[model samples]
Target: MKRIGVIMHGITGRMGYNQHLVRSVLAIRDQGGVVLKSGERVMLDPILVGRNGAKIEEIAKKHNVARWTTDIDAALANPDDTLFFDAGTTQMRGSLLEKAIKAGKNVYCEKPISDTMEEALAIARLAESAGIKHGVVQDKLFLPGLRKLAMLRDSGFFGKILSVRGEFGYWVFEGDWQPAQRPSWNYRLKDGGGIILDMLCHWRYVLDNLFGPVKSVSCLGATHIPERFDEQGKAYKADADDAAYATFELEGGAIAHINSSWAVRVRRDDLVTFQVDGTHGSAVAGLTK
Candidate 1:
C-alpha cells in the first residue's frame, strides 16, 4: 500500500468539514482507500489543521483522526506531508498556497485562488517554478447532472449549441428572525466576500468545459440585503454583492447568461439549474436529476 500524507487545512468550516474531510477523505479511508490501475492500494493519511485547537480536537476525536494541530508552520514543515489542501476563507487562500508551495508541498485548494488576478498569477508562477502539482477545486463539473450534460454534449445531443442559461443560489436567512445559512464574512468586502467573485469562478469553468471557452463577459452585481446578523446575532453592514447577473460570449459564438443570487427564492427543481438550447434540442441540468 502506498500512503500519501495530506495536510488538511480549515476543516472546521462547514464545507471543509462536511464535504472535504468527512464525505471525501474519510469516506475514501472507509472504503479501504483507492486502487490504482496497477492494483496498488493508495491510502491517504490526513493531518487536520485549523485555528481553533479545541474545535479541531473535538472533530478529530469524533472522526477518529489521529493527527490534529493549530500550528500551520509546523504542519507545513513536516516533510511527511506531500499534499496540502485548503478550504479556508478566500482572503487567506493565496498566501496559504504560496506558503505550501514554497514548503515543497503539492496544493489543492478551493476556488477564487486569490482575491486579485495579480496575486493569483504570481502564485501560479511560483508553483510552476517550484515544480509542484497544484489545482483549484471545481466540484460543480463533477456533479452527476453536469456529468450527464457532458455526456450529452459529447454524443452531439445538443447539436449547434446556441445558448446556455444558468440560475444558481437560494435565499439565505438574514440572521435576525432566522440564522443566516452562510458566514457573515461572505457579505463583507474587506473579508473577500462577493457573489461575483464566488459564483463567476464556477460559471467560468462550467461554460468553458461544457459549452465553449468564454471570450468576453458583461456583469452586473448587487448587494440585495444591506444588513445581516452575524454568528453572534449581531447586526453588521453587508458591503459585498449578494447577487450577480453575468453574460459571457463563448469562443464558438455560443452565448451564456447566468443569474446568481443569495436572495432569490427557489421555485425550480433544484437550488441551481442550467438550461442549454441548441438547434437540435434542449436540456436542463441541476444538482440532481
Candidate 2:
C-alpha cells in the first residue's frame, strides 16, 4: 500500500465540501480505495484542514476521517504527510501553494490556479523547480457526456474536427422567489469570481484536449443583475460579470464559440452542451443522460 497524507484546506466551502471531500476523496475510499496496476492499494490519509472547526468536525465524522485541524504549520511539519491539496478561494491560493511547495509537498489544486496568468506561471515554475508532482482539477472532462465524446473523437468516428460550439447557462433566480444559490462573493470583482474566469478554465482544457490549443481569443461580458442580497440578508452591489460570449481560434484552424451565462433560464433538460462538426460526420453532446 502507498501511504499518503493530504492537507486539505477549504473543507467548509461549497466546492471543497461537495467535490473534494464527498465526491473525490470519500468516494475514492469507498471503492476499496485507489489501486495501482500492480495490485498495490493507494491508501489516502486525508487531514481535513479548515478555518471552521465545527464544520470540519461535522464533515470528518460523516466521512469517517479521524485527522482534522485548522493549523497549517502543524500539518506541514508532520513527517507522515506527503501531499497538499488546495481548494481555497482564488485570491489565497498562490500564497498557500507557495508555502506548500516550500514545505516539500506534492500539490493538487482546483483551477484558474491563480487569478492572473503571471501568478499561475509562477506556481508552475515552482512546481517544476521542486520536481513535485502536480495536477489541476479538470473535472469536467471526466463527466460522462464529455468522456463519451472523447472516445468517439479518439476512434475517429468524427473524421477531423472542424468546429465546436458550446452553450452553457442557467437562470440564477432571485432570493425572494427561489433563493440565491450562488455565494455573494461570486458577484464581486475583488473576490476572483466571474463567469469568464470560472468557466473559461474548463474551456481552456476542453478546447485544448478535444479541439486544439487556442491561438487567440476575443470575448465580451456583462453583468445582467446589478444588485443582490447577501447571505446575511444585507444589500450588496454586484460588480462582476454574469455572462460571457467568446470566440477562439485554435492552432490548427479550428474555431470555437462559447456562450456562458448565469442570467438565463434552463428551459430544456440540458443546461450545458456542445456540438462538434467534422469532415466525415458530426456529433451533438450535452450534460444530460
Candidate 3:
C-alpha cells in the first residue's frame, strides 16, 4: 500500500476541523483508500498539527486520527510527510504555506493565500521558484450544480451565453442571542475578514472556469454592519466589507455580476444562487438542487 503522509495544520478550527479533518480526510479514511489510474492504492495518513495540543488531541481522539502535535516545524521536517495542508487563520496562512513550500513539501491551503494581492502573488512566485506543487481551495467551481452548468456549456446549451449573475449571502448572527455560525475572524478587517475579499476570490475562479476568462472587474464594497460581538462576548468594530456589489467583463464579452453579503436574512433557499443568461435559454442554480 502506498501511504501518503499529510500534515494537517489548524484542523482544530471550525472550518478546518469539521470540513477538512472530519468530512474530508476522515471520510476518505472511512472508505478503504483512493486508487490511482496506475492501479496503485493510495492511503491518507494525516497527522493533525495545531497550537492547541489538547484541542487537537481531543479532536484526534474523537475522530480516531492516529497522531496529533503542536510542533509544526518538526512535523514539516518529517520526510515521511509529503503534503502540507492549511485551513487556518487567513492572516497567518501566508507564512505557514511559505514554510511548507521552503521545506519542499507540496502545499495546499484555503483561498486568498494572502490578504494583499502583492503578497498572494509573491507566494505563488516563491512556490514556483521552489518548484513545489501548490494549490488554493476553489471548491465552489466543483459543486454539483456548477458541474451541471459545465455540462450544459459543453453541449452548447448556452448558445452564445450572454451573461452570468449570482446572489450569495446570509445573516450572520452576532454572538448576542444565538452564537454566530461563521468564524469570528470573518467580521474583522485586520484578521483578513470581509465579504469582498472572501467571496470575490471564489467568484473569480467560478466565473473564469464556468463562464469565461474575466478580463476586468468593477467592484464596490461596504461595511454594512459596523460592530459585532466576537467569540469572547466583546463588541469590535467591523472595518471589513460585510457586503459587495461587483461586475466582471469576461474574455468572450460575457458580463458577470455577483452581489455577496452577510447582512440579509436567507428566505429563498437563497444562501447562494447563480443564473446564466444565454441567447437560446436561461437557467438558475442554487446551493443544492
Candidate 4:
C-alpha cells in the first residue's frame, strides 16, 4: 500500500470541498480505496490543513479523518512523503505550489494553475526542475458528455470535423433576494478569478485533446452586472468579467466558437451544450433532460 499523505488547504471553499475533499480523496477512501495494477493499494491519507480551525474540525469529523492542522509548515515538515494537492484560491496558488515543490512534494493543482500564463508556465517549470510529478486538474474532459464525445471521435463518427460551437452559462441570481452562490472573490479581478480564466482553461484542454491544438484565439469579455449584493446584504462592485466570447483557430484548420457567461438565465435544463459538425455527421451534446 502506498501510504500517501496530502496537504490540503482552502477546504472551506465550494470547489475545494466538493471536488478535492469529497470527490478525489474522501469519496475514493469510502469506496474501500484505489487499487493499483500491481495489487498495491494507493491509499491517500489527507491531513486536513487550512486557515480556519473550526471548519477544518467539522470537515475532519465528517470525513472521519483524525489528522488535522492549521499549520501548513508543520505538515510540510511531517515525515510522510506527501503529495501536495492545492485547491486554493487562484491568487494564492503560485507561491503555495512553489513552497510545496521546495518541500519535495509531488503537486496536483487545480486550474487555471495560476492567474497568468507566465505564472502557470513558471510553476510547470519549477515542478519539472524539481523532478516532481505535477498535474493540473482538467476535470471537464472526464465528464460523461465529454467522454461520449471522445467515444464518437475514436469511432470516427464525425468524419473530418469541420467546425465546433459551445454554449455555456446561466443567469446567476443577483444574490440580492438570495445570497450569491459563487464566492465573492470570484468577481474580483485581483483575486485571479473571472469567466474567461475560469472557463477557457477547460476549453483549452477540450479543444486541444478532442478537436485540435488551438493555433490562435480572439476573445472579448464584459461585466454585465457591476453591483452584486454579498451575503451580509452589502453591495459590492464586481471587477471581473461575467461573460466571454471567444473564437479559436485550431492547428488542423478546424474552427471553434465558445460563449461562457454568468448573466444569462437557463430556461433549458442544459446550461452547457455544444454542437460538432463534420463532413459525415453532426452531434449535439450537453446536460439533457
Which candidate should be chosen as best, given TM-score against the real structure? 1
For model 2, residues 85-139, the per-residue Cα lDDT tens digits are: 9988999999989999999999999887899889999999999999999999998
lDDT of 2: 0.87
lDDT for position 259 in model 3: 92
Predictions in order: lDDT: 0.93, 0.87, 0.87, 0.86
Question: Residue by residue across 93-200, what tens digits does model 3's lDDT show?
Answer: 889988999998999998889888888889999999998888999987777788888888888988998999999987788777787787778888777888887889
Q: What does candidate 4's lDDT look like per residue over 1-289, in tens digits? A: 6778888877788999998899878987887778988898877888988899988999999889888999999988876947888888888889999999999998898887887789889989999999989998888887778788778888999999999899999768768888777877778787776899899888888999999999999999999999887768888889899999999999878999999998787775587787889888999887442
Task: Please identify model 1 stretches exceeding 4 Å from their true place.
Answer: none
Please give the range of 10 consecutive residues that has the lowest summed lDDT in model 2. Answer: 170-179
Ranking by TM-score: 1, 3, 4, 2
Model 4 ranges with Cα > 4 A deviation: 287-289
- Worst lDDT window (10 residues) for model 1? 263-272
**Predicted structure 1: lDDT:** 0.93
* Position 256, candidate 4: lDDT: 97
In model 2, the runs with Cα more than 4 Å from the true position are: none
- Candidate 1 lDDT over residue span 1-289, tens digit each: 9999999998988899999999999999999999999999999999999999999999999999999999999999999999999999988999999999999999999888998999999999999999999999889889988998899999999999999999998878999999889999889999888999988999999898889999999999999899999999999999999999999999989999999998776667787899999989999989686
